[model samples]
Structure formats: C-alpha cells, structure tokens
Target: MDIHYRADIKGGLLILHPAMGIVISGKVTIGKNLTLVGGNVIGFSTGINNPFIIGNNCSLGANAVIIGPIILEDEIKIGASACVIKNCINKGVTLVGVPAKEINKA
Candidate 1:
C-alpha cells in the first residue's frame, strides 16, 4: 500500500524515504524542506482541538508518530517509533523514545 496522504499535505512539504508506513490524519502543518520517512505517522493524538505542526527542514524517522498540538522547530530530527505527546522542541535537536526526549542538539 502506498502510505501517504497527498490530500493532507500542505504547500512546500516533502515526504521522503518512507521505509515502512505513513498514515496522515487530522490537521498537520508541515513547513518547507520537511522530510518524513516511511513508517512516520503524523496526525492527531485524539479527537481534540489541536493538531501537529512540524517545522522547516525537519526529518522524521521510520515509525515515528507525531501527535497532539505541538511545535517542532526547524531542523528537528525524530527517531524511529518515537511518540511525541505535547511539547515544543527547539531547532536543531534530535528527539527519541516514548514521550520523545531531547536526545541531542543537532
């Protein structure tokens, strides 16, 4: 199955290297130069009012799930299968694991 929702995509967003599966639901805003790998699921955590906002030049690893109303700044890198609940990450950083911790500043 082609795991991508072109309809959910916005202007100037790029999805690349999807190695597994990608399911896009809810309201998602992806900035320019953004790349999502296969297995990266970008959508809402629940039937809430907020959605997910990914910053420019951001890269999501395979199986990474970004949910809720959160802000991922530019140049953000997410590890595979990482679960991001609700938080704001600074630019040039790498997040991993459940609840998504700031592993390193890239």
Candidate 2:
C-alpha cells in the first residue's frame, strides 16, 4: 500500500492491510480510524479536482475505488469492488455495487 506523503490522516488509528494495493493521492484528507482492504484506490479522477476527503471510522473493502473530489462522511463503509464517484454525506451507510449506491445503513 502506497500512501502519498502529502495525504493527511487527521489523528487516530489507520489499519491498512499489507496485501492491499491502496493508492491515495497527495491531496486527499483522511479522518481517524480508517480501515482499508486490498486493491483500494482513493484518488482524483483524470481532469477532475483533487482533495478527496474521508471522514472518521470509515472502512473500504477490497477493490473499492473512491475517486475525484468526493467526500465520505463518518462511519461509511464501501463494499468490495465498489466505485464511488460522488459525495456521501449520510453517515453510517454501507455502499455497494458499481457506482456505489447506499444499500444499507450501519
């Protein structure tokens, strides 16, 4: 997992698996207690804005791609192989499938 040096983790614990192929952009801001599984990408889309913001206690499953200038709120969970391109303002939600729709509330 290669997290860019300029990517900000604003305190608390971050659990990143060793086998995970996580790529985080330098302009990304991650909040506390983030758990990232394998093949997760948190980055900006090509020709899009930077500064992806993730809130606290968020968990990203395997192959989850969170791209562009999206904002993920607290306690959000992204399912495996999900692609998130928009802002998720609702907390405690579990997003799944392609384009990452909210399937359930945790």
Candidate 3:
C-alpha cells in the first residue's frame, strides 16, 4: 500500500486490510473508520489539482477505484470493482458498477 506522506487519516479505527495494491495520493483527505480492501485506488484526475476528500465511516470494496477531485460523504459503501468518478454526496448508500451509481438508499 502506498499512502502518500501528505495524505491524512483524520478518524480513528481505520483499517486497510491486505493493504497491498492500494494506492492513495498525498493530496487525498480520508475521514475516520475507513475500511479499504485490496486493489483500491484513490487519487486525482489528469490535469486536476483538487484532492479527493473522503468522509467518515466509508467502506471501499475490493478493486474499487475512486479517482478525480470528488467528495464522498459519510457512510458511503462502494461495491467491489466499482468505479467512482464523481462525487457521492448522498450519505448512507451503496454505490455500484462503473461510474458508480447509488443502488440502495440504505
């Protein structure tokens, strides 16, 4: 797992299991209690300077990819192999599929 020096883990009880293959950019800001599975990629987009901001209690499934300057609100659940390119402002929901759309309100 490559978590850049500038990346901040603001919350407690964060878990990065099998941390291998997880790439987090320095410009990212992660909230508390995050559980990231293997093969997760959280970073910026091409030519974009803004950083990715992840809210608290988020769970990213295996092989999930979240790129670009986006905001993931609290309690967001990303499904396996999901790709999130936009901001997931809706809290307490499960997002799935390519370009990840909210599947369940939860």
Ranking by TM-score: 3, 2, 1
lDDT of 2 by residue, 41-86 (tens): 8888677665579999998888888886888899999999999988
lDDT of 2: 0.85
Q: What would the per-residue lDDT of candidate 1 be over residues 1-106, giving only the tens digit for each residue?
A: 2434542444555666544666776467777776777777776656567546777888888788887567778888889889887665678998999988997886
Candidate 1 backbone collisions, by pair: 18-37, 18-38, 19-38, 21-39, 39-63
The per-prediction CA RMSD against the true structure, in angstroms, equals: 2.7, 1.7, 1.6
Q: What is candidate 2's CA lDDT for residue 99?
A: 86
Candidate 2 residue pairs that clash: none
All candidates' TM-scores?
Answer: 0.78, 0.88, 0.89
Q: Which candidate is the best by TM-score?
A: 3
